[model samples]
Target: MEFFEKLKALSYRARLTIVLHTVFTLAETIGGVFFNLYLWRLTSSLALIAQYQFFFWLAMMLGFILIGYAFKNKGMSQLFRIGFWLNFIFFCLIVWLGERSINWTVYLGLLSGLAAGFYWSAHEVMVLSGTSDKTREMFYGVLMSGESVARIAGPALSAGLIWLGAKWRGEALFGYYLLFAFVALLFLVTELAINRVKDVSFERFSLRGVFGLYQRKAWRWNLWRSFVDGLMISRWFVWGVLSYLILTSEVWLGTMMSLVGVLAIISNILIGQWFKPNLRARLNSWGAALLVIAGIAYPLLLNPLGLVFDQILGEIIGIPLFTFAWLAWFYLAVETDYDGKKRQFEYYAGHEIWQGIGRILSIGLFWLLASNLEQVNLARWWFGGLSLLFIVQWWLLKKVRTALVKAGYKEE
Candidate 1:
């Protein structure tokens, strides 16, 4: 009822946009779990996992750049549809190849990455497409809540499918087969929702328009902020193999992930409904500080209970507030700036490159290090390194926040 009450206050477009995003994210979360599961069940090599992600993000970054250069505003909307079809095809290829799928890991990564790029490039633009500044913060809060819900539901549901299939067929991969078919269907549902939210036009794109954004004093630090934010990409996605190996139970893994969503639901709802424009600084600073503490604990404690604790702290004190603060500032900057909106495609594409560069460097380093370094040492090098990067990211965000305000935009 409370969630429904909040949605009632937003525009129909905004409501539909939230549904679109929620469903896409739900599909992504399900696919993510299975992709990791399939590869690990076959290869059991963490470095190969990193390599797969490396190509995926590399493809994703290049995809954004290519789409930026190639697509007009109208074509931009079509990227959403393209991503779904490609992703569906990727899943089909994986299922078709079966045990032989490991042979196509490189091509698989490239395909997955390009599909993700198309999906997210549209996401970048549509994030604020449906709402005005007046309702932007609330939109984010609700959006966060919905995404959290999806994250929890996706994994729990997947785990159940796996368990059911394992019981019935006595084969774990059978569960993945079922999950893949279901997620492909989800893509169709996501596309349907996207069509309901009518497209809005951004300023005409030109190479010169993109280069002009780099010259702006306010935007310079925001780009750097994105790079710093990217340093944690490895931290975010590579956990499926580790968790499954560590706990040896997808049930436990799914439960832990579901708990994260439960906590996020509480936090995001509060942030969305109760947060004020003035709390941005406090919220961000608090989130970063807790991230340092939680991140450090994450690497230091490697057991099942320890990982659960780490997730709890990250959701409660770290990710939710921090995400809200940064995103509010991020979307606000683009919403108000004259050049920022006119050159929005280039603007988001540039951020993607900077962040993608950071992700590639970190994930690529993981691929290299995981091959050479011991597991315990690699844990410290990976998670501990991300802790420090989060602080730097927050500091850069502070600079951008100040620069945006000084550039004549209000904090809201």
Candidate 2:
């Protein structure tokens, strides 16, 4: 309908790039989840899973560190081109490891992380460059919608593939590995096509030169914001919770994850077309409100259901219940007001910092308390704390939103 027309009018290059990158993201999701599951099956240890996660984050952190600097000095498309090849190589390497029967779950996880690090930092940098403040929110929402769609399909398809692989190859792990290899090839081909796009730049790089971007106050602030935001939700909290949940229940986890992905897709559509275009501030406020509600309800409701069902509910709707709201707010924030060349880089750096902090805090405090306390006691404690956390996070978001609004970041 009119929605497609509006999207087409936004920017042809932006739409094409988003669609192309979405294809890559879809493959990565499918390959990534299955690879992690394959490793889990091989090790059958939560500790191993945790180790895998640790290396994954470490690799990603390193990638971001390097790319953050490069993004400051070099061009966006240049970064994109480099990221594609790096990711493609690592994907092939992972497949090679699988072929050798080197089922070192920890190393495999690290490898995946390393590959992803290059792909993500570059991808974000490039995509963010394609839009400006007036359209950035809608742009991010659309981009995320593509990712959400991929996530929805990835887990469901993975589960089915796992089942089929076991039946056909007589070894489920082998089947998973085969699927991963295929996806990697798909990535390689896509990257090749993307690079061939006329006018895509491939500029030179230098670590020392990137520091010049910091001289611009706008860019500096953007980086700070991104780092803080990234820290809050980055690999830390998500990975820790995921590892814990996987140890508790894998099958249910995959199913519920896909369900969440489906919800995210719906949310993305609403965000991109309706919320982003019309009510940026309202979306921010609503997202905070949802968090406030869910934070209180989750622990209270989950305990009685027992761990497995509780996990399913949490995965499917409980965790994401507040997250979508938070994300809606952040995407809008990024899309507005900030005028800078290396916006995503700066924002991501700051976001990564906060994400790291949040992860550390959650892992240290939330995980500790959740792990040690009696289930009933923990449930009671978390119910109250979750509510409090939601309120506090909402307050913080409100402050940020207010500040941004004061700075004149309103919808057109």
Candidate 3:
């Protein structure tokens, strides 16, 4: 029975794709953190770093939209291929400009944003097709675990490379470029490997048929519920991530990010292994509630701590930092069984839109209100208010969960 079961599992397309995807994720994860660190180092301005984040998020939003239409039109594979190579080229460009100057760093940020735009959209769509919702959430957890591992491994490796470069008369940014090159190499290799996998026919990959599920009233309500859950939470996460960048230094940023990554990985593992699929929806609701609290507290927290200590805590808490935990939760929520294709897209779109809104509002708030407040005042009052918001967020999540039950959702 064990032999037969192993054989059966080996025949699954998703399992194969997950393996290939993991390889791609590991490289990108390392390359991406190093890239961000280098960019922050060059500019040392939180606003500029936030601008880079804005562009990256904006690109993903637009890319997902286009990928949706493209999937509907049967051009999914072509666009994804474009994404793979575009990422390759983008990393290569970063490698070519490893002098660590301000202008080059700005250029790197733009290119990285462009690359992320391509990579995230295509990668997400591809992953969606590769697994059903039954396994997709678990699959996502696995993939994230790979990334979290990379988070720890990438920085450690980059730190080593930086040391080597220092000894060899090479610039520190060269270490970043080296990591980029290695990651780009992984993308190309994976692209080649994916070509060998059996191609998914557009007919079997149905946008219309899948979307028809959304026509059901139950699914529609569930989707809307999921969307609200995402919107309420993501606003604070993005705001906090950028705000922290303003205060954190490049040298320690990767280590801090890695700690957050570790927390996310742990979360993903717990969800995939212990949480039942039905219960996962409620868990997402709870997670979003936590995010709202974290969101409100993070800025206040950043305000009070000097950049150094803030950096220390950011690593320890891992919630509102520059890690992927927020998006991971948002995706898990949207991909719940109660949601249909329409809701999935809506959830994705809503998450991005809310993040964008949060970024804009937070920036304004900081500049208008918090910027003038002394660190002590900001810490005491701002964090206090944030803590209250978290409590509110928790209440809101419970209310949403109850509403889901009232709407006849057996799981959520």
- Highest TM-score among the candidates is held by which one? 1
Residue-by-residue lDDT tens digits, candidate 1, 233-303:
88765556656766787777777788788788788887777666788888889888888887877667767
Per-model TM-score, in order, reads: 0.94, 0.71, 0.66
Clashing pairs in 1: none
| Candidate 1 ranges with C-alpha deviation above 4 Å | 1-6, 192-197
Clashes of each: 0, 22, 1
- lDDT rank, highest first? 1, 2, 3
* Whole-model lDDT values for every prediction: 0.77, 0.54, 0.50
- Compose the digit string of candidate 2's lDDT tens values, residues 53-139: 556656666666666655555545555556566666656776677634334645665566666666666555555555555565566
TM-score of 2: 0.71
